[model samples]
Target: MPAVTVPDLTVLPRVSAPGVAAASRPVVSITSAPSGTEGEGFPVKRAFAGVDLSVLDPFIHLDEMGEVDYAPGEPKGTPWHPHRGFETVTYIIDGIFDHQDSYGGGGSITDGDTQWMTAGSGLLHIEAPPEHLVVSGGLFHGFQLWVNLPRVDKMKAPSYQDLRSRDVALATSADGGTLLRVIAGDVAGLQGPGSTHTPMAMLHATLAPGAELDLPWRPDFNALVYVMAGDGFVGPQQAPISAGHLAVLGAGDALRISAAQRQQQRYATGLEVLVLGGQPIREPIAWAGPFVMNTRDEVVQAFEDFQAGRLGQPLPHAEVGDPVG
Candidate 1:
């Protein structure tokens, strides 16, 4: 949960409170993420499970990687895989992950670090725990989100961005009861470091017990809130939400979340949540396995290209694991 922190939240820039005319978004739906296994058997929570694609336009998939503390030699990660027509955004809240791609893009990211890889056109990549981390064993927690690219940018040259925790825009609520780490897009005039292909905003927030956060949001971008730890209420209706839960919000200019007065000892710090939203693409989606495209033919072509070795090959120096799909 130590993605980013400050000695005193009051010293950070404060997010202005919404005006009286601002409309508060209502909770449209709340769903609990189902636990599952991914990559080389690492446990994950399918955060977008059971949610309609139309409601999640521009966002294809989301996996909440383990909050588990692993013993020596128990850590695991994804094998080399091919992707096309989308981007993968991996955020590490704790522990370390090493990433390498075929197009000469690779790096090791740790606590609060982020790796943004655009798989436009297609490329091969792998993600695994660093050797030291795997040998020593430790706590590993994070999230991987798949963002869909519009048809125009689907075949654009691939790119990578390594965003460190120190580069994130830090902000606090007016009362200084909540801390926000903006990773992408604009929040109350504060711009995040990560640049996105689509218009979107992503942030991680920690609210003190019993504190309330009324956040201003873009009326055009769809809104979603996922609780990473502790319990809280979302939207203006005060719907109860807890860890592993995702809340989809309706149209509005603002969002309201309130943390419970008491929390379990494990989460005494506050309620941890990831808030994200993007302008809906509103186009037909054709997704399968690791590729996301706008038509069935495009998805088929992606698979064919990957199988024919057109995507790219693994680095000669790296160990190859089982294929993702």
Candidate 2:
């Protein structure tokens, strides 16, 4: 496969959302994305849960990984790790990812697929590109969201949900310009295939030029928008956010997102965005690496449990080639 070229996004000026009229339901705040890496050597642009995890409520972090081109012979993938007291949601847009877990869970998540893993009590897993893909080179793009469990569900048993693209519900507005795919919540009464114990909405939408969406949302949920592949106007004042920026919606009756044209007419091919929201847990969060609990003692206990081999054991997987990094 040929090398994939990922463009570097330019930082834009901050546009305040609070000044917009209440009816517009302007954005509460806009958070810029910062570059980072995860796993063995997976590069990412982090949108939230960097400086502070409190403001995001039940959500911990959102990472934009890949859309990168890997040359043939490149080796890169996530090694083994443990997670507890929360869930990991991954949405794949391109390429392939191989998943293995201590529960003997193994599968391939291809393009437009989603993997929702609940590491309730404990889980040890590894997610990485297929050995062939890493060795032959390919395009990779996806988003991984960390959702925090409330105190009650923190110790529940582990579970997994793999949603294929064909099964995911896609809804288009009465007009032709807007399209939406509900992955975890309901859209137009169409429920997503990925179910969650937590109350939340995970929507993937694409808008044509001049198309817009004004969706009704609960006031109590902490709503946020991450521009995935294009620029758009957000909130009431219509704050402009380019690809890679994540906007946290302010208090309002609903959300207003419009497909916007750039000064030079960007997004000629259209735009894509991910809308996520969840109810606030309003409880103490004690987090250390992969463990999230109610207090420091629980965090220490999680570590102790891992040390005692309480986390599930990982099963062996067939490998075409060994990953390099």
Candidate 3:
């Protein structure tokens, strides 16, 4: 219950690839999540928009958590979209999620729920949720991290933070088989109540089978580890990995995970890992889908301020079209 004593993953300093680049240290990249191919029904693989790592420099993107099996009615989710700059946590973990936006913010998250949002200067969201009372089961798993908006706060406006599941902050691992859930920053000692504008950190582990955990890296940020369904041993080069894979570690100082006693329950004890990165803002991004401004005229002035409506505001329980697995 009291653990945040972090600081040990040290190894940093040693750049010289293209020659020098290390503001505070955080360079670790990894991208791997392929399967959903044959027709895309995703019998097993499903990365709607997952796998996309970006080392430190202020944590650009991390999306490495997937699952969506809503077919009882059709229409899945993500509708009234439009963001500006960055910030969109959205961790769900099992099923259900309603979400509304434009600044009014809405609700419904169910399964362990977590909906961070912080679009900055523009908004226009929607997540929808209904149908799929569990027939095909394993509805809309989760993971939707996409941060990057520190260049002067990118716009400073849009915001939200509906973290539930008992206000977060849990940390167990003696033989109870790992738990740790400080979903924002800080680490073991625990301190994740959502209130990040950048300078990030997030941990949401779970072991169970043969369990054995260490995790505590912040040699200035930029970290990685996304396995999610089983196979163990990470960091300290125990390597190994499994379920979809993604370790990516280097400028280290702390990290030591375990679980293989024949992998305990034969792997798959829950294992929904994701320990994002931060400390990187080499600016000049200016993306174009779901907005990510920097230029291109601020994405054409954010679609002309949502077509002159001035970025509509008034969310929270404003259900219109629901269905999110």
Q: Indicate which candidate wins on TM-score.
A: 1
TM-score of each: 0.96, 0.86, 0.34
Model 1 lDDT on a 0 to 1 scale = 0.89
- In the range 75-95, model 2's lDDT, one tens digit per residue, is 467767778889998888888
Evaluated at residue 293, the lDDT of candidate 3 is: 67
Select the stronger candidate by lDDT from 1 and 3. Answer: 1
List pairs with backbone clashes in candidate 1. none
Model 1 clash tally, residue pairs: 0
Please report, as a residue range, the 10-residue window in candidate 2 with the lowest summed lDDT.
Answer: 1-10
lDDT of 3 by residue, 287-320 (tens): 6656676678887887777666566663443222
- lDDT of each residue in 286-310, candidate 1, tens digit only: 8888888999999899888887778
The per-residue C-alpha lDDT of model 3 at residue 163 equals 87
Separately for all candidates shown, the number of backbone clashes (residues 3 or more apart, or on different chains) is 0, 5, 19
lDDT of each: 0.89, 0.75, 0.60
